[model samples]
Target chain A: MTALLEVSGIEKSFGGIRALNGCSLTVERGMIHGLIGPNGSGKTTLFNVLTGYENPDAGEVRLDGVVITGIGPGKVFRLGIGRTFQLTRVFIRLSVLDNMLIAAQHQHKWLRSALRSPGQGGERAKAMELLDFVGIARLAELEAGALSYGQRKLLELAYLLMADPDVLLLDEPAGGVNPTLINQLADKIKELNSAGKTILVVEHNMEFVMGICGRITVMHQGRALLTDVPAAVRSDPRVLDAYLGGAEDEGLEAEAVRTEGGSK
Target chain B: MAILSAKAKPISKGKAAVVVAAIAVIAVFPLVFTNPAVTEIAIFALMFMATSEAWNGFAGWSGYFSLGHAVFFGVGAYTFAIIANDYKLPAGSGLFLLMPVAGVVAMVAAVLVGAVALRTKRHTFVVITIGVFFIFQLLGYNLSITAGASGLQVPTPYNWNAATFNNPFYYAAAILLGFTVGLYWIIRRSAFGLQLLAIRDDEERAKGLGVPVWRVKLSAFVISSFPVGMAGALFAFLIGQIYPNTVFNPLFDLSWALMTLVGGIGTIAGPLLGGVVLESVQQYLNLYLSNADIYLIVYGVVFLAVMFWMPRGVVPTVGDALRRRRGAGEATIAATNNGGTDSSSEGKATGSLAGVVQEGGK
Candidate 1:
């Protein structure tokens, strides 16, 4: 399949440290692509670059054959890219329904939307639907801040989904969610992908990543070490060394069992 | 057609009673005090209400504390004075005409300042606005049409008889108050108001949700300028004179800001309540403390007290108290409804956490 997103020779640096150095990756349409790396391996930096929160020193980011580099987050959103933050950057004071409506509001013209009430146009109904999709429909009327850590994660996911973006960037959906909710989130991602949506997830949860991701791209020190099917990538010597520091089959078997259980 | 027809949902009895009581008290105010001086005080109180509401539209709702709002007020006063005195327009008509003209001027001023000042952080923005006001004040004093420092006298409208102009000031004040209140109601009910609240609580997050921060702030700034300009024109007409010193007085600005802040920063009723109370206290203090300088000191103390005691403003604090009482009452009702067992625990658990997270994020 043609690459839905293409990054060519992307390079970004903060002062003396290289965050992303000559990093390039292709994300195909209708797939849950995973980007996994250790802390400070430039996973979040790459996400920021893709979402236009940060500009690469040198690179081209093409979304479906259209170059979209150095654009602001709002413009990136307008161009069919939606993102959720790792820290759950939600509008806290607003009601759960209002949060979703605000995200969905991107579809309207700026001036008109500002002047007119967003509650109209079936936005409330749609927000409730998204809440239901994320299994947090009952909390729609409550303040978003009142939700638990796991629920907030789900709300963040539902909020991004309201935008109906072609490409969804989930920084770490399963990071703070409980085990039960992790499985539910994985299922939601699968459902989203099966419905022709493109997803690029950056996650540290190996089980969650290996289970749902159609393809996994492992990174180290800001460069993509390997991109392939999860099974092959798991056995690769370099991938093992980079991830597990040359651990034997025991570590690999444990990870495989966890992935299977997480998928279930 | 259905016979029920929604049953008109009898206006919440509690709210209705309060509204009725307030109206009765307001209607009897003039009767209780026939002294023209007290009546003038009442009129001034109403005018302050309008000004406070205007300020609240931008500062309170949108979280843009514009210290230079006095510019719009001064512009309105000067615009009316110039139109009525210099241009030789009819007095009452001139004042009304100047309202829109001053509104436009203020809107333009807000846009220009907002373009540059909005780019800065909150405190810097406030200082920039104050700087803009100082510049306007200097220009007002130097400009010939503004009567320089001497002040211009506004001739009463030719069409009105003695009684019309005599009590007409009170009527004008009432109309202005109504207009201000109505405008606030529209804004608060509209999507723009919600967006403003969202922006005030958190700008970046609002922007991330595609709020068009600049546009929302600009629109509010423009709307806020209209009333302020109108208030200035009315002040000029009521006093029948305008001077740079009188029109662009820092005392008025300080009073308006302090009153609005003490009344409640973000609530709709805050400015109105704050303005009335603060202006009344000022009038009373003037009766005893004849020194204007002493009044300023007293005003400073009042502002300090309000800041320390009620940081969120009077209205929102009252609202929180009322909400807490209602929540307690509801809890009892829920306990009774569920046979002393709270099924609402699940709902409360989820709802409470959501509130905390939202507050923490804010």
Candidate 2:
């Protein structure tokens, strides 16, 4: 299948430090692609560039063969690239349902419908449906700030689904979430992919990534070292060396142990 | 049916009843009272409400702190003054015709200012607005037609008796205030308003959610300028003069910010309640104190007190308290109804929330 998102030769630097240098990756349609790396591997930086939070010094990003480089975050989002932050940025003061509603596309002419009721047009029901999809419908009335960390991550995930973007860029979806919720998150990611959505996930949780991602791109020191099936990536000597030197070997070992000890 | 359907959310019956009764009293207020001082205070209160609500639209709702909204106010007063000076027309209706003209002028200026200012970050936007405010104030001082620092006196076009004179301006102010408040309510329920609130809570996230942040904020700023500009025009006519120092004073901007904060910054009713309470206090202080500066000191103390005790402002703080009390009462009722099993469920919800609240703040 042709790639849904193509990032080629992305070069970004901050001061003297190179965050992304000649980084390249392609995410195929209808697949969960995991970008795995140790801390400071520039995985999040790549996500930021792809989502137009930061422009690359030299590179090109294409969504479905359409150039979207340097379009700015909002325009990139409109062009169907949804992203979540590593720190989980949500409207903390707003209710969870309103949070989802805000993410719903407003197609009306700007000035014409500005005076109309926001809660009209079945947006509420759609938002609630998304909230239920993420298992947070019961907490929809509470301020998003009231949600637990795992729940916030789930809400952020659900918020992306509100737009039903062509591609989702999730930054560390499994981080800080409990094991049970992490499994559920993985299941949801699988379900979304099976439903034909393209997902580009940046994650540190080895087992979670290895279990969910069909294709794995191993990044090291601001570059993609290799892209292959998860099984091949898990066994690759270069991937092992990168993780061993980069201090994420424990997570790598955990993935191996989980796969051997469990069904996957 | 239209009114009910238009509401973004259902209003409590108690609140609706209270609002109806309040509007009735205000409608007949001028008919019963003829005291100029009382009428003047009423007029000032209405004008302040309109201006504060206008300022609250963008600044309070979107967390964009604009310290230079008086730029529009000054632009409006000058628009009216300039038009009145240049045109020789029929008496009573001429001033009314200029109101919308002043509003349009202020709105166009807002579009220009918002275009440039909103490009900057929030803190820088405030500074840019201040810069624009000073530029206009300087223009007001130096422009030959503005009559310089001596100011311009607007001639009373119509031969109006005391009640007739006071009544029209009062009604005008009241109508403007009503329109502004209604517009605010409509915006609060609209999709654009939700976008603004999203930006307020988290701008980057809102952008990621596909809200055109700059454009939505600019629209708010332009809409806000209308009522503020119109209020400025009416005030110019009410006072029968326009001056750079008085009309475009930075204090007017401060008052707008202050009134909104006192009411509850982002709440719909906050600005109105804040305007009424603060304006009444100012009028009282003016009546009681010979020196005006002491009242300024009192304002500082009141601001500090509110900041310390009710950082969310009066309305939200009180509302939260009432909600908590009602929640506790409901828990009590639910406990009796369910033989105390509801207590643990309630505890589970709030207990987990305490940790999340602190975590979310980070």
Query: TM-score of the second chain in each model?
Result: 0.82, 0.88
Clashing pairs in 1: A145-B354, A145-B355, A145-B357, A145-B358, A146-B353, A146-B354, A146-B355, A147-B353, A147-B354
TM-score of each prediction: 0.85, 0.91
Residue lDDT tens for model 1, B242-351:
87877787777677778878777665677888899988778777766684656677777888887787666776666556655665778654333321111111122111
**lDDT of candidate 1 at residue A219, scale 0 to 100:** 81
User: What does candidate 2's lDDT look like per residue over B1-362, in tens digits?
Assistant: 12213324545555678678978877888888877778787888889988998999889878889988998898898888888878854457458768878999999999998888989888898899899899889989999989889998776755788655688888888889889988887787677877887888788888877777878989999999999889888988888888999888988888888888877787777788889888777876786676465657767887899888877677766655655666686865432322212211122112123434655465
Model 1 - which docking category? acceptable
The worst-scoring run of ten residues by lDDT in candidate 2 chain B lies at B340-349
In candidate 2, residue A261 scores what lDDT? 48
Which residue pairs overlap in candidate 2's backbone? none
Q: Which candidate's TM-score is highest?
A: 2
Q: Pick the candidate with the highest DockQ.
A: 2
Whose lDDT is greatest here? 2
